[model samples]
Target: MATFATSDQLLVIIDPAARQTDGESVRIVKDVLSAGAAAKVCLPEGPEEFARALGRRGSRRPVVVGDDRALVRAVTLLHRHRELAGCALSVVPVGSTLALAQSLGVPTSAVAAARTVLDGVERRLDLLVDDSDGVVLGALDIPPAPVRAAAVAEPVSAASGRPWLRTTYRSLVRTLAPRPPRLAAVPAPGPCRLRVEVDGATVVDLDQPVEAVSVTPGSSGAAEVEVRPLSVGAEATPLRASGRTVTVVGGDFRYRADALVSGPVRRRTWTVSEAAWALTLPAHP
Candidate 1:
């Protein structure tokens, strides 16, 4: 339902750090946008360098050429600048593990993804902000220990995984990686009570001792909160919720705040806040 004028300009911002990791692909990105030549492109130093670039972005539909982290950074910048509410955000994902791009329906190959940028559609999706001031969308996973190799020598470790997975890489990395994200709140076998209030309901009482608790707040306050006992192979996908605040109770625990990895403390309690931030996504492809 959102539209940008063909006459309007476009600005491209590529994360410099992303460039180092995928230099060739970054060149491809520049070439594709340069193929347009006339569209304005803004290159920032990194996630931290985006603010000044933020001040200069005009009314043109913004195009991002990088991985999920870069995408998140740009969107967060626009949201903070109050530009997301009105603009159509686009991404030409350049990373091998660009899962969120697939979720957004952008092509994976730099060239094809660029074509999507050339002819794209717009969608208004939800943005997630954690209690520790982290902003994200697509996923916030709390994984168990990485699945170790069975003593057999393999050509690749999860850390060294090829960027060749295309659309299936994210799920693959999530499944095969030996080391996964940790939970700040959940300790080992020792059980601790956690309080959970979803949509303001005391759904999880203090009587339950859980291996860990996960809460995700969705758009409009629809929330899903869950707690599971810890077992050697036990796992839980990040739960979804849409409450303003989720207060946990019981023994002290810490939690990861998005990609920063687990770092929250509950002096027997934790509060999770959910809200959407402005994000510019690809418009046509």
Candidate 2:
């Protein structure tokens, strides 16, 4: 087991969802953190209490025991308070689906992760800050109208297996029935009219319609921007750019950032902030 510098003060914020879903993991986390440090635990029932607890945390290092959303909440709160640059946050993956924490090099298991809290090193990372001061630690994607249409029209299985039976019956009827008359093709919806600019350079003008747009933070302090155009007869090429800032202007458009969907606004700009925050992760061998 890795050893710490001893008697490190820690503030453990256990999300309510973590307590409800995995009591055992929560107990393990509390136990391990207590064993290694002067750990003070906080069980906030909701967002308000959660915020209050952190605001009163003093100088203790904050350790979150929850899933990805919980981690994001803590980070967002810290960022807003202007304390993110000074704090090195730690997380114990206590609930289901901790892909974000794991991808950031945190141990998935409760015991290993809690141990990491005591023994891990801090690593600085970049962030995408929107015009509204909202933060995105991961990729942002904007899909075309056709993709949304397909998602909406997709069918689900019924309790009686009627969807499967319907498919089978339709297949048999098509084989036995007479040929039906063909119908004319319906016109597809027009592309999204967006004016995309990267580092002040226009990638897609207002007249140039696009299929999708994605922005992600690259390793070299730049945001990777991609603008996919609507396909014509053949495959359509995607316009790509990388810069410190990206701005998109259009009529009420929405985009997905990480797991959250945001906008329907006329404009949004994302600027890359290099090494804006730090996280505790296991040291390399």
Best by the TM-score measure = 2
Model 2, residue 107: distance off in Å is 2.7
TM-score of each: 0.64, 0.77
Off by over 4 Å in 1: 1-8, 130-133, 141-193, 212-221, 224-226, 229-252, 256-258, 267-285
Q: Give the TM-score of candidate 2.
A: 0.77
Cα distance off (Å), candidate 1, residue 243:
5.7
Residue-level lDDT of model 2, residues 1-285, one tens digit each, is: 544443388999999989977888899899989998888899999999999988888888999999888888888999999989998889998776587788778999999999998998998988999989888887787742322221211223352367678787668867997885565564544568899999899999989778889898887699989898878889789999999999999999888776566778899999999999888888872
What lDDT does the true structure give each of the candidates? 0.58, 0.84
Off by over 4 Å in 2: 1-7, 144-191
Candidate 2: count the clashes: 0
Query: What does candidate 1's lDDT look like per residue over 1-285, in tens digits?
Result: 334456345777776756756778878777876665347767777555666765576656677777777777766676666666676677888754477767756678888877666665555555555454455555443322222332422333464555655336567755888974553554333555666665466755666545666554455534445656444465644333445555565544545433334433553222322334333334633
